[model samples]
Target chain A: MSRLSINQQTVKQLSLPELIRACTAVGVDAVGLWREPVAEYGLVRSAELFTSAGFSVTSLCRGGFFTAADPADRRRAIQDNRAAIDETAALGAPVLVLVAGGLPAGSRDLRGARAQVVDAIAELAPYAAERGVRLAIEPLHPMFTSDRCVVSTLAQSLDIAEQFPVAQVGVCVDTYHLWWDPDLDAGISRAGERIAAYQLADWTTPLPAGVLTGRGQIGDGCVDFPAFTEAVLATGYTGPIEVEIFNDELWKRDGAAVVAEIAARYPACVGTAS
Target chain B: MSRLSINQQTVKQLSLPELIRACTAVGVDAVGLWREPVAEYGLVRSAELFTSAGFSVTSLCRGGFFTAADPADRRRAIQDNRAAIDETAALGAPVLVLVAGGLPAGSRDLRGARAQVVDAIAELAPYAAERGVRLAIEPLHPMFTSDRCVVSTLAQSLDIAEQFPVAQVGVCVDTYHLWWDPDLDAGISRAGERIAAYQLADWTTPLPAGVLTGRGQIGDGCVDFPAFTEAVLATGYTGPIEVEIFNDELWKRDGAAVVAEIAARYPACVGTAS
Candidate 1:
């Protein structure tokens, strides 16, 4: 229970104040937030609210979209990411997750797009490090490779992360995005301390249109959570385990009810160590 | 032109006779086939139609689904696959493509499901070889890992293929399924002689529900087709390059127009050598 955190997207309808109240009611010690919601609630006020309620911000949702064909657009993306870094710092969140952007319009050069990601991250990592925020590269599923994030595997994320200081850059391990990988266990082991954040969601079938917001809640799909938890625990990772499901059905329910259900379902999914 | 083949699914509305006439009109020398349509048209008659039209059947559409949990169902799948091998031989197709099935209902053991695929292929390879048919493992996109196919990358398919004689087992390389992989070139180079069927389709976003029939037409999306063709050709593969898109819009169009569009679009996408 001490290690469990509820990502706000899991209960997207909940207001910041309502979310804090629900977390307190459910005894959740931490929360992961998305940039838009935090901004909507006023970043400083949200930060103050969480801090006052004795809840830690595990991570800020995102800070990357560096692959653009236009040079000016790319520059703007970098600036936006810098703002995200500042937000992470203001919220007292140690990790800022990055979803490397997809291929630019009419550009089929995947390698070139990937190189841009590396260059963008290299430029941003020092800034993040200086602000005391770790940039966590979250590899989306390969289904998102064309339109969302070009980084589609933990190994690929690590390849980029290894080029930087471990304290400043690392990979985010999310089961929903990586459950099908044959080399997952080895990648997780190699990630070790470079795992800046660990997230939970299950792999469900008949993926929705756009393939986003289809993540299954833990125990609702085919992810072997115990095995994943064991693998992460073996890495000596004692950080918060955040539930970050994005199902449309789950989002439609009352926020408190969703939190209650998550609390009830979480214990069996977490490994023996937790 | 000699190396070009139109997979039936790319112009699925056409009957066997219409497909033959359209391919002949378009100067396509080969056609890849699906089991249901061929069976519907009469396997012997479909084979005769292609042969009479001087068309080589590049490969059979599919012949794998070995992840059933029930013993009887597993046995049935094996038996059905053996029949498919016979069909491949009867059609004089050198390759029989396999889409390894997904996890068993309610089972979270991905490794177990994958192991089952290995065992099923091991059991079927000898029979296929005896029929002078090479079993080509088609690694589907990871999006299909849960419900459609567990084999999700060319490397993983090669790992299973290497266990058998290359003459008996090979891999089907489809650009739509593998364009996202950073290691694709290396995988293709390593595939060298084990490359059986090479396919083409572009990667499009906002994927429809089920993520099945949403493949973009060639040149309509972000896949770098030339690079893929070059990689495969670098491996000395002088085989049929099949265009196999499964777009809903394409499916609704006139079959002859679809083939004509494919013919026009294909020249720009194929390698210089082809």
Candidate 2:
């Protein structure tokens, strides 16, 4: 119960104040937040508000999109990421999640795009570390490879993280994005202490358009939460297990009700595996 | 030009006679057939129709789904796969593409399901080899990993293929599925003589529901066809290069027109990468 955190996107319909209130109602003391809504709520105010409300910021949603080939575009992306890192620091979030951007328009060089990700991270990692924030490389599912992320496997994320200082860079483990991997257990074992943040969203079928917003609730899909939780826990990870869903169906429901449901499912589906 | 094979699903709107005429009109002498359509057109008749039309059958559509946990269900799958292998032989298709089944209902054992695929293939490989038909394990995109094939990488498919006699088993290299993989080059190089069938499809986004029919037309998406062709060709794979799109828009168009577009795009996007 203490380890469960609800990422704001799971109840996207709620405003920051609404979310905080809902969490208070449901006895959720922690949450993961996205950049857009956090900014909308006034960053410093939200940070102060969460602290006063007794909520821990598990992670900050994003800080990457470094695949642009154009130098100017790349510079803009880097600047934006630096701002994100600063926001993460200000919000008392130790981890800033990164979604490596998709292929630039008309680009065929996936290798080139991936190289760009490495270079950008190299620039940002030091800044993030100085500010006491860790950059979490979140490998989206392969369906998003061309349009969202080149980092599709946990092993690949670990490969990037290993090149940097262990304290500064790490990878996000999300069941929704990685449940399909056969080499997952090995990758998780290898990730060990480099595990920055742990998230859960089940793999549901008939994926909707854009393949985004179709994530299932914890118990509604095929992912074995116990096995994943056990693997991450085996790595000595005592961090929060964030419930991060992007389902349109869940978003339309009452935010408090959704949080309550998540609180219930966390125990039943993700059981304490230690 | 001589190596191009249009899989039936690419132009699924066309009947057997219509597809034959469409190919003849465009000077296409090779095709990949699907089991359902072939059965619909009569197995013996499809074989006769194709042979008399001077069309080489590059590969038969499918023959796997061995993840069922029940003994009775497993036996039925084995029987069905045997029939598919027989159909491959009858059609003069040297390869039978196998889409390994997803998790059995309510099961979280992805490793176990994958093992089932290998075991079923082991059972079917000798039978396929006897008939001069090679089993080609087709690892679907990770997006299909749950409801379709648990085998999500060419490397994983190759891992399974390596277990059997080279003459009896191999893998289908599909551009759409394998393009996202960073280790694809290594997988293709390792495949070498075991590359039974080479397939092409682009990775367009904003994927529709079910994700079954959203495959892109050859040059319509992000796949680098030349890179894939060069790698496969470098493996000494001289088999027909199949264009297998599952696009909804393409299916709605005149089938002959779609084939003509594929023929044009094959040269432009795929090129003669010898």
How would you encode candidate 1's per-residue C-alpha lDDT over A95-156 as one tens digit per residue?
99999999998888889999999999999999999999999999999999988899999999
- What TM-score does each of the candidates earn? 0.99, 0.99
- What lDDT tens digits, residue by residue, belong to model 1 across residues B1-274? 7888999999999998899889889888799999999999999999998998888999997999999999899999999999999999999999999999999999988999999999999999999999999999999999899898999998999999999999999999999999999888889999999999999998898899888999999989988888888889989998999999999999999999999999988888885757
Report DockQ per prediction, comma-separated. Answer: 0.87, 0.84
- The 10-residue segment with the lowest total lDDT in model 1 chain A: A265-274
lDDT of each: 0.93, 0.92
Model 2: fraction of the reference interface contacts it also forms:
0.82
Off by over 4 Å in 2: none
The candidate scoring highest on lDDT is 1
Best by DockQ: 1
Q: Chain A only: list TM-scores of all candidates.
A: 0.99, 0.99
Q: What value does the lDDT take at residue B128 in candidate 1?
A: 97
